[model samples]
Every structure is written in C-alpha cells, then in structure tokens.
Target: MVCITFMSTTAMAREAPIFLVAHPDVATRGLNTDTARAIFAMRQRTWPSGQAARVFVLNNNDSVHARFAKEHLAVYPHQLQLAWDRMVFSGTGQAPNLVRDQEEMRERVATTPGAIGYLEREYLDDSVQVISME
Candidate 1:
C-alpha cells in the first residue's frame, strides 16, 4: 500500500504546469498586457470576460501568474490578498473566479470569450494567442 501510494505521488508530481488560454479572436480585440494589468489591478473595469474582467488565476500555487502580476500588473500577491481580504471582509470588487487547473481556465475562456487569464506557454494552442508583455 505504501509503495503504491508513493508511486501515485510521483505520478502527480510529474504533472505539467498550468496553462492559461483565451480565444484567439478575443486575444487581439480584448485586453493587452497593459489593459490586463489595469484589469487585474481593478483600475479597468469590464472586459471581454463577462465577469467584470475575469482575472484568471493560474492555480493558487502558480509562479507564472505571480511573475506576470509583479512585472505587468505592478502588484504583488500580498496586495491582492489585502484587496480580497478587504473585499470579503468589507465590500468592493468581487473576488476572482477560481479555476482548479489550467484546463479549466481554458474551458472558461473558450466558452466565455471575454475572459482573460494566464497559462503555461506549452498549453497555448491555436485557440488562444498569448498577449505579449510590453
């Protein structure tokens, strides 16, 4: 039993990083890096994501989203933590929708069309084009 459990653990550890995707069409027309930053920062309201500019989170453990947030959004996870803390404890911009994994993010973005989120560079298919950071 212990050996089997360990094998399963190793299998899951080999899993790939999450990839965020969006419809290729929405990629050009909707938020670019700057606009995405603004949207993530709550500076810009509304987007191709019907959910008040869906700021897709690449799983809670994703470093990619953190890097993007710091580099483009110019904010750290702590800021978001505080923001959400306030929003939940008080009230303001609603909390971002949580997608369990990259696949879910892709599905959400593909169906909604307005949603924007980050994904692993590998998961990007012709379905969604990556918005280059400026």
Candidate 2:
C-alpha cells in the first residue's frame, strides 16, 4: 500500500507540466533549449539580452526537480549535480542557488533580477514571466 501510494505521487509530479520562469525584468521571452541547458548547467552566465543570469533550483532529490531536469532540460538530476560538483571543485563556476520548494522557487525568481527557474502552473503569478523554450 505504501509503495503504491509513493508510486502514484511520483507519477503525478512527473505528469505536471513545468514552466520555465524568469524575473519579470528579463528582456527575452524565449530561449533555445541549448541556451537554457547551458544556463542551468552553469556554462552560460548571461541571458541573450546580456543580463547576468542568476539560476535557482529546487533540491536535487525533489520530484519537481527531477521532472524539470528530464522533461524540460533533457538531462537527469544526477547529471546536473555532477556538473555543478565539477564546476565547484575546479573553481570554474558554482552551483545554482537552491530553493526549498516551489513557493520559494517562485518567490526567488520573482524577486531577483535576471533570475531563472522552473515552476508548475499553480505556483506562477504576475511577478514572474513565463519563458518559452524553443
């Protein structure tokens, strides 16, 4: 019974459509997948419009984090962690700022200029802009 419940909850989270969200002040409304991937991977430091990009993320183990990683970014959570780890260890870059949950994800993205993160539809509000991924 417990196993079935956990599976279903995981299934539901995977099914939820994740939106790429950014601060309202970010100039671009859309980004190519490669650029988005680079930003999240800490390889790209600025938005196309030349704004310094600040990336936020939920905990690596969070279901929403896994879903957004695989479904939207075409990468796994473990892979992202490894990339972040490599950057941190080599002093080339740093890990993204971690938010505790979707509420925090939305709040941080909304408040920070050039911020980028993902959220489910329910957590979105006027303070952030939904960025379309091509």
Candidate 1: list runs displaced more than 4 Å: 1-21, 25-34, 48-52
lDDT of 1 by residue, 37-86 (tens): 66665556675444445566664456666665675567787686667667
Worst 10 residues of 1 by lDDT: 14-23
State candidate 1's TM-score: 0.65
C-alpha RMSD by candidate, in order: 7.2, 4.0
Assess candidate 2 and give its lDDT.
0.94
Local accuracy of candidate 2 as per-residue lDDT tens digits, 1-134: 35543456655654668999999999999998889999999999999999999999999889899989998889999999999999999999999999999999999999999999999999989989999989
Q: Candidate 2, clashing residue pairs?
A: none
- Can you give the lDDT of residue 41 in candidate 1? 56
